[model samples]
Target: MKPPLDLDQLQTFITIADTGSFTRAAEEVHRTQSAVSMQMRRLEERIGKPLFEKEGRSNRLTEEGERLLSYARRLLYLNRETLAAFDDQRLEGTIRIGTPDDYADRFLPEIMARFSRSNPRVELTVVCEPTPGLVDQIKRGQLDIALVTHNDARGQSEVVRREPLLWVGSVNHATHEQEVLPMAFGRPTCVWRRAACDVLDGMNREYRILFTSFSATVITAAVLSGLAISVLPECALRPGMRVLGEADGFGPLPDCRIGLMRGQTDQPEIVDALARHIAESLDNISVPALDDATGLGFGAQALGRGRRGTATILPGW
Candidate 1:
């Protein structure tokens, strides 16, 4: 009988599937692209089938690969469960995680779930606040760690993800075509709000803030209801909303960076483990920040030439 398929190899396969790029998979697995290719070759030899085939610009999975995917995911889940079941450490601690609601909805599920499953005794406390607020909480030692967005390029931040801030409007309404663009944004201190207004002001664009709320959902509702167009991360663009572009004549929305910030308190081993899980959960994300070619493809003309759809696989980021 052939040797059993390796769990790590299966994970690599899943990462490639999740990321849709070998380079990204390599980054996820902390290996070289050549190493991933070699693993694929080994996996193919064991199964007597080719798993991947080259497609236009991307290496798409072959039919055989697709068939293997469902099995691989099941096997990996079982493997993790088995390990967790056997782990004797039985870690117990409290983890106070802070994140903006936008990110809380997009990114924390897998990290929290896995951490909870492995360390059943660990109590988790999640606080949903704006990025600036989260950072403040961390600074005050009120939060164990926080995921936040800022223009901080110094040693103070470890970038976990980058996303484009696009001009978003409702699909049925052409709210962006008005003489003076009406905007719905978060609080004045919001990084995206600051970036959007600065860019519009610098370009001398006529605009007004029709609504302001700290809640992204509310801002999204405003856009979806045709109340006003707003600046939002690509991840925040729901189905009913359309992305505005240079062709639309609106000023550019600057990209945002999400970073992992440590608190002032000393981190315990459990906290370190949780941090590792957070990093691993967000690995290999392909966030093309505002590249017209394959980025959001917001423009009509840009959408015509192959659509480079946004990656929602990073889950909640």
Candidate 2:
């Protein structure tokens, strides 16, 4: 049988030992110094030994207290691990998803592959569209979820990730100011194109639209040939591209939102599993700063092949 534990006493003991001062321990645990002193006294009594010895204004753990410190950390760590284990098993549902073309190219493939391995039964239907198109599809209930670039997600979907949009051009191109730049993007329904235009408009900058295509490949190809510059997500800066400048301080663009849209009733078990897997997978990815490039060859080789009708796995879907 396990011995009875006074958790409060044990916690107080650990806190005081860690901080090496009653006053500091009290501050850390958000308790009054007098209360902390009383808790420590009670802990000593329960253990039937002196846990600390006072020297001047500070405290030091006695030999017994030192021994107990190891046990305390193990206990707290085990408690958290146990809680996480239970939660990990509780999530299960099919999450039909739509997202922007760039997101599919940059980050979704690895995430999807990992998700498939972890939750094989989850039927994931991922549609690659421009950000605005994805948002529209979700609103119309054609998609159960969408990952879009909308700031605030106000009156819309849930924002999952926020990062700055940046200016990118082909390495071969000499970048001009916004006024003289030739631009490439998806069709008019693209939020990134809108954001870029909005910025240029506000700055009273004149620019020309060189190409429009839903395919990231087309836009990238055009940009690579020095036909245009584009405002793109930081992650989209591959080796062939160069950052001309930081984003022209547009109002916060919509974050990459992974919204749990209403009215999805596929295989509940499968949907839930996929959603959980996605959430977990995304959490593990570290979004790097715009200054340091994540490099190309991630999807460029396969994507650059110019072959259509190939089966591909997208991320947010």
What residue runs in model 2 are displaced by over 4 Å at the alpha carbon?
1-95, 151-155, 177-179, 246-263, 266-273, 287-317
What digit string (tens of lDDT, one per residue) describes model 1 on residues 145-244? Answer: 8877755732276776666667777777888888898898888777777788898899888999998888666787788888897776655555577778
Worst 10 residues of 1 by lDDT: 306-315
Displacement of the residue 267 alpha carbon in candidate 1, Å: 4.5
How large is the C-alpha RMSD of every model relative to the true structure? Answer: 7.1, 12.5
Model 1 residue 236 lDDT score: 55
Best candidate per TM-score, number? 1
Number of the top lDDT candidate:
1
lDDT of 1: 0.72
Query: Estimated TM-score per prediction?
Result: 0.68, 0.55
Predicted candidate 2 versus true structure: per-residue lDDT over 1-317, tens digit per residue: 74765667677777787578888889888899999888888777877888899888889989898777656655654454355455656334456777666666655775687665555545678898766566667667787665565533423654444444555666655655445778887677556677778877877677889888777677777767778877655445556666553343323333223343332555556555455444444444443222234223322332222111122212121
